[model samples]
Target: MIFRQICSEKGGSLAYVLGDPVTREAVLIDVAENHLTAAEDFLRSRGLQLRLLLVTHWNASHEQAARALRERWGARLAAHESVHAPCVDMRTRDEDVLYFGEESLRIFHTPALTPCASIYAWNDRLFTGHTILVRGLHPKLHGQARVRLLARLCALLERFPEETLLYPGVENQGRRLSSIEEFRRRSQHGAGGDSADLLQRYRHLLPNKRAAKQREKARAEKNLHRYGPGQDVPASL
Candidate 1:
């Protein structure tokens, strides 16, 4: 397999390009609108035909790019069933296998950060979109709900080999990549302690519901301003 990771200039959103060297077929994951040209250029340079654009979650940025990419490359667009993107040609479910040439990615519905968030695993790498970050996990839920969510996430992660590489949707604090083992070591969610005690210890680290809403509102406003009312911003940004 051939692979490259592209970082968007605006929001440091990460996009992945993976190609099957034997078949010369490729796929893109978490493609950002701003990096569409670059992605196209990379495919052209490699002499690989794009087969699909797989989104990890629904967002303004990805929604806009997905349509343009599909039109340009005639590649199929796929996402979680809960995603309401018009460009999506395929609605994937947990354990669904997406194929491109000889390469295959297994989809895992790992929601909590967003209803449609998912993880794609190929070989030893996991492409986690907003579901898991190098700095911390998404803090959209709190209290007992948060604890249960964390436990669920931990369960899924623990199923993977410790050496598996994690490619997050966005870069945090200049770090864009981590290993499952490393994340498990640094995150409280990885601890064997009870969910209640773990939740208590990490409760302060997560934002309150009100603050999270305010942040979401602010982000929405910012997107509206940047892309104009109905326009789409780059997904990763």
Candidate 2:
């Protein structure tokens, strides 16, 4: 099995690479536009073939990249029906299990269809698309439906083992990994709670004006490596 966490410098979004080393079949999750060069180099080096280019959510930052990568890799583009991307070749549904070689990924549809639209589970990791963060900063979602979403998120977190790693959509504090137990403990969300209360408590969650400024500052800061393992690949769109 081959697994990697890639951070796009443009949006600071997290992209993932999951592959069956034995079969040489791979999947790219929310890969970025600037990520193409490195991805190609790595795949070529490993002799891996991309079978699926899966988007947990169709965001502006990744749309062009996804399309370009699909064309370059000739991999099938997969997304939820709600995404409405004409480029998408596979309209995945909730609980849909997609297979590539000997590996499989189970998709779980979430409320926010733009950023945190879906969560994909592969092995012990959960690609939580923007729905989760190690900082316990769940995306600030409007609409009454988020109440249900919060309750559902709590339930989802409960179902997974404490050790299960969470690979969230956006980068948090330059980190790319967390766990169910660590999230529950650090985020101040205990076992179970009322959705309404959860909303009230975390209504101001996600990025605020201050956070945006922080990100801009982080953008100025540079990384040493270009696109090696665990490298933060920064580039403009």
For lDDT, the strongest prediction is: 1
**lDDT (Cα) of model 1:** 0.82
The local distance difference test score of model 2 is 0.75
Give per-residue CA lDDT, model 2, range 90-126, as digits (tens). 8888899999999998998886535338889998989
**lDDT for each candidate structure:** 0.82, 0.75
TM-score of each: 0.78, 0.75
* Candidate 1 C-alpha lDDT tens digits along 45-131: 999999999988888888888888888888999999997666789999998998999889999997776888889999899999787
- lDDT value, residue 162 of candidate 1: 94
Q: Model 2 — which ten-residue stretch has the worst lDDT? A: 222-231
